[model samples]
Target: MLSNILLITAVGLGSFRSVQSQSTPSICDNSTLLIDSRQVLTTAQECTAVAGDIVIQYASDYPATIEFPNLESIDGSFLSINFDEDIRVTRLSAPKLKSVTADVYISRWVNLTTINMPVLTTINRVRLNNLPSLTSANFLSTLESIENNYEVTNTSLKEITNDKLPFAVFVEIFDNKELEKFELKGLKNASYNVALRRNKPGVEVSLPALKEVFYFEFQRISSLEIPELERVIGHFVVNDSTVESLEAPKLQNVGLWYDPSISITNNRGLVIQNSGDSESLSFPVLEAVQLDLVIRNNSALRDISFPMLRRVTGNIGLEGTFESVRLPELDRVGGIFSLGNDEAGFNCGDLQAFKTNGTIRGEFSCPRYQELPTRSSSIGESEKEIKDWLNWASPSTGFESFRSMGAVAFAIGISTILLVL
Candidate 1:
């Protein structure tokens, strides 16, 4: 076999020249402190506990504040990314780095401003991207814990407070063009996701000690507080906000487990009939919504209440211009039950007795409502038309799940070509 492939290509070129001659690792050796030249940034300012990782690249004459005065703890990540040029460190003083078991990536640092890690607490992830002259990041007020994500993008950092982080799974802050304000005031719980988009448009958010969450998305807000949230194991979206009003005084539930979707879009003066924006499409004490609940194009929402809603395992779309539509303890609605109100003595006779009594098992519109179907963004048979869309939310393009595994893999490739004839 060609001399055993030339002795395994000479033992893989001698193991790539012994890993390119151990890419310069010395100070507090546990490897990786590749601070590219300037004598490895003065031997990484004499590391003070750095098991591994500490990449600060692109250096041709580095300096201008890079102090690490006796760095402390960093069993991993602490990168200072630089895609090619632009990385003339403005400031990165690790004032006694507290902890960073994993990531603390600062990407595309376009002339970093200041990141004096004034006692970083506990971290597993903290991605700060495209920093446009990062406006000081005093360690986000001593974080307490973060097992996963805590992202902040396109920063100029106007405000970002954390009354000693309590708990979170994933926190995203988007395109921060001088981020207005944010408050995580001792987050109580955030089991999964918490997203915010395209910032700097009258932003002012507050968590006020969140109670529970699995997924929460808020966009373009003016002021949206979560005064002690209750629960949400899945979705709870509030879109294109101008945040006129939308209270959740201890909400109850909104989709848990499989089949879940809730989108309250284009909030333009969310619900207003009385003085207080008619409870501002309130949820004084919501009940359940384990599947699809789309509230569209908010035009000063006329009036709509879920007064202790009962259940909805799917679809329950409600369009704008409403006068009054309350689901007095709705029992059930597993699929389609739309309402496209135009106001003016709006009444659908108790939702047509919930589809003439049966608790609406499927398709049932009210007061001439339409356009209520959109999920499954791909995957066969037009994704089963979207109604009770759930095959884990689209993915098994029918055909009886590929007809017995494509007929036993085409009968084992025709019995392996008749046993080679």
Candidate 2:
């Protein structure tokens, strides 16, 4: 009986000690726990301050400022907060803030390695003017806006396309000289004004729903097709490429005026040779052409035909070795006609048939026949004396019987003098 009672008393004391040790909070614990300046804790749990949370202030002790020096990653699935009314959450900077939730807005965030912020997909605002050392950013799969008329400028980004962001008032991706390929496939139904200028070399851009392109350079590309391109409020240049054919039927508007005359120059391999025998091939209707209809240096070119060309208000010069030019309804050319440096196979019979309003100045010859010699205007003394004498006597030469009348008058005068003697 005595041993049983001693055993019960010892077991009860051991249970009390176990509860006391487990209930003690550690120094890192901030969940509903209060600590004095000199007090220490024994738990590793982080703090969660509610709206009416309180903290003990000390005279010589300092509050925490976010200084993440040796942090590898912030992987805690916990909620963090500030204790005071001003809500200074400055003590929580991490080197690798990966897979974090909630829309976090921080100013002067200097020590972050990379903002792989897939969680912060919809950013209402971001201010990085004070963060000079920030290097890279991993955007969300559906990142929308960084404020209105905003972009990520002055950085080293290779390819940027927010698959979730397509609609805005204005968007600019300018001065990104190192960026190569940009595909806005998510912008199929957007009604925004987008401009992309001065990209890197060998870049192929595709914007199917593009309405207004300020300027796009397909200089080093092989093929380009925008079947739904409707308008271009500025210039559209396609230079230095091997684009063989260009057929855009739904391309309605181009420049400030609809289908304004465009210049496609310096492309050696670009052949816009329409082959169909239709009445009119459809091209973008242009108001006025500022430069010449520059068709030069295309050696493989055979024919130049525009069946629907109602009016050519500018100069149309076809200078290469083209076989023929067939423009059926062409009228009202604003300048002269020129065809130069074509050796053989010159069949301008269709152009020569139409009585041109402008002057024609070429020798049309064939392989078997020599070119008809150009008639020269003679200005020699014999020709000049003949012209001057004819001009003086031409009016008198028109009178009826003037030659016979003068001969008869001289004979009558001599007959009368003989009769009187």
Worst 10 residues of 2 by lDDT: 412-421
Clashes (backbone N, CA, C under 3 Å), per candidate, total 0, 9
Candidate 1 local lDDT, 1-421, one digit each (tens): 9999999999999988777545333565756777876777777777777888888878767787778788888899988776454556778898999998999998886887889998899989899998877888988768899888888999899998889898878889999898889888998887787888888877889998888877778777677789788776666777777777777767677644432232322211112122222225567576666546666666766555656666655667776664555666665665677777665555566566676666666788876677655444343322243233332222111010012112211000000000000
Over all chains combined, what TM-score does candidate 1 have? 0.36
Model 1, residue 2: what's the lDDT? 95
Which candidate's lDDT is highest? 1
RMSD in Å for all candidates: 19.7, 26.1
